[model samples]
Target: MLHLRAVCPPEQTDQAIELLRAHAGTAHLIVHRGAAVAPEGDLIEVDLAREAADEVVDSLCALRLDRTGGITLEALDTALSDAADAAEEAAPGEGADAVVWQELLGRTGEESRWNATFQAFLVIACLLAAVGVITDSPVTVVGAMVVGPEFGPLAALAVGAVLRRWDLLRQAAAALAVGFPVAMVFTGAIVLLGDAVGVFDTAAIVGNHEVDFVYQVGEASFVVALLAGAAGMLAMTSAKSAALVGVFISVTTVPAAGYAMVAAVAGSWDRAGYSILQLFVNLVGIVLAAAIVLILRRRKQRSGDLLRPLSRG
Candidate 1:
């Protein structure tokens, strides 16, 4: 469920109220007229089911409430009231299964921001992977995967493709295009520095066998990437965030980039080529799989069965 607060103009208040009151999925509707000072409008608040939030928000926007007034939506983590139960029951589908499209757009937009924190995490993660691959340590490789922030832009890429948001596509693409190379270069320089200090050597790349999977790309890599992408996108869309950790650990994206950079630093072109190929294959598989998942989910949301009102039919 979601809590929606709207500051609506006097003229549009009645229409907005009517829209919410008419919807079976809305409950706990309250109106305090002329209560807002900033926008100078009446304050209206309502509880909306996850399955019905998109429809209600769309209708509210159609009334120009978002332009002249304001709308704030927040998820109800603990809705103990019976009204919340009634709202969910009246909605078209289970809350967990609902795909709130605007919410996803907002979330992806936030995650795709290429700020300093993003760069820091990516570089640190790649550096960890480089060490893990050099030392042939599976535990370190897993740690690198856990620490990597690469999934956000990848998920945003899939979202942009599905929504046809060219700006989002470009932003996400830029993040990936610039982020990977930046991380790799930084990791390579660090590896070279370590070699000069005798902390790492060429034998690390040539003799390692335990973490060799980091550089090996094959049918399994694509299949694993496809599965992870599908699961990750689904988790994001449905707000089941706990499932994303599994997706993060399952994909070999960070490990491949880390290994490739380290191998290149050690003058192992063959290994670098294989690792780069692994990275490319994983990326393509994930984007393709995630886009397909979003496309199918949007289709399901548009279907009459899910959109039909529960109260009427």
Candidate 2:
């Protein structure tokens, strides 16, 4: 659910209220006129269900309240009121299983954009992975995985597949297809240069025992990917973003990519291929898991709405 607090001039209050009313799917109306301490205008509070949040926000944006006059909008977090509880109880099964794919797509698109922050994260993750492989430290490898930002694109791709949004799928695929290879090449070059300078050696790459752990593919890897993907999607949508850090640390894609680069530099083509395969396995598992979850959520939403008609009568 979403709660909004708006301080708008007398002239804009009516329009703002209208916008909220029109877009909010199950809004429990609350009007407190002329009870604001802002000394500028009335304080209008709006409470909306979670499913209706996106539409209500869109309507609010359309009003241009931010630009027009001295209007301020603030989001509030609060428990549902009795009225809201009653409304939910009355509606029962209505919209219970709605997928809200467009909302999820919008979120994916926003997070998966190829931006400077993402590039920096990618570089850092790859660097960490290379360093980890050279040092033969599982801790460092996990750190590198945690630092990687590749999951956003992967999640976006899964969402695209579920929604059948070709544009989103294309953008996500390009990012993943282009981004990982680029990171690998750059890291591989670094490894090569380091090797030439005697800063890294074949023994450090091949003798370092961490390669065995990353190259082996099994049900554990698939399960980890599946759990990470679900947690990632939840983190993206949920207010608790801090949990995503944990999700990032749990995946092996970055570590495997880094290991692959190290193996290539050390002239261990077999190990390099194995590492690459491991990375692919994890990536595919994550995308498939996320897509399935999204599809299920959508189906549940549809079933809920079908059972209960919009009109109470």
Candidate 3:
């Protein structure tokens, strides 16, 4: 279930009430006229079925309430009321499968940005992977993979493609374009300095066959990329934070990028090429997989899955 808090202008209060009352999925509607001081409007609150959220939100948007007032939605982790249950039962789809566009857009919007913290995390994660590659340590590589924040933009890019949002797509592109290269350059410089001090060398980077999978581009790379991509998208859309961690370590994006830098600095052109290819494969595979999932989800939502209640298992 979803809880909605909408502030409606006086002129639109009747329309809002009419719309909510007409919807079978809406329940526990409470109206406080002239209660919203900041927006100077009536405060309307209701509990809605997850499946019905998109339609209701769209209606509100169409009414221009989004511009004139405000609407905020929150997921109900547990709703014990029979009224809530009836509302859910009256709705069209399962809560778990509902595609709450507003929530998704808000989530991806924040994540897709190349903020200072995101950049710092990326650099730090890549540097850790660089160390892992040089030391031939699987643990350090996994640590770097978990720390990398590249998935945010990648997920955003997938969402943008599915929704046809050019702004989001461009922002995601710029983030990856700028963030990765910058991290790689910094990692490469670190490698160069380490090389100058005799602490890093080409042999250590190229001879680690145990972790060669990080740089080796082959059939398995594509498979892992596809799986990771799908899992990543599911995590983002479903609010599965724990599953997200698995997606992080399951793919080679960060490690490959770090390896590319390390190999380039060591003058191992072939190794660098392999690492770069691995990175590209992972990126393409993930985006493609994620885009497919998002499109399918959108389709399902349109098919009234978003309006139907979940069947008790």
Cα lDDT tens digits, model 3, 1-313, are 8899999999999999888888878889999999999889999999998877888898888989898999999888888899888888877657666778888888888898998898999999999999999888899999999999999899999989889989999999999999999999999998899888998774677565677888889998999899999988887776465788899998999999999988888789898999999999999999999998898888876766443433322
* Tens digits of lDDT, candidate 2, 12-70: 78887776655424455555677656556667776655555544555555665544433
Error of 2 at 243 (Å): 4.1
lDDT winner between candidates 2 and 3: 3
lDDT ranking, high to low: 1, 3, 2
The top-ranked prediction according to TM-score is 1
State TM-scores per candidate.
0.95, 0.75, 0.93
Error in Å for residue 260 of model 1: 0.7
Q: Encode model 1's per-residue lDDT on 1-313: one tens digit a residue.
A: 8999999999989988888998889989999999999989999999999888888888899998889999988998888889888888888877888888878888888888788888899999999999998888989999999999888889899999889998898888898888889999999999999988999874667874889999888999999999999999999989697999999899889999999988888889999999999999989998899999999988888894554774423
Q: RMSD per prediction, one decimal?
A: 1.6, 5.5, 2.9
Error of 2 at 197 (Å): 2.0
Better of 1 and 2 by lDDT: 1
Runs in model 1 lying further than 4 Å from the true structure: 305-307, 310-313
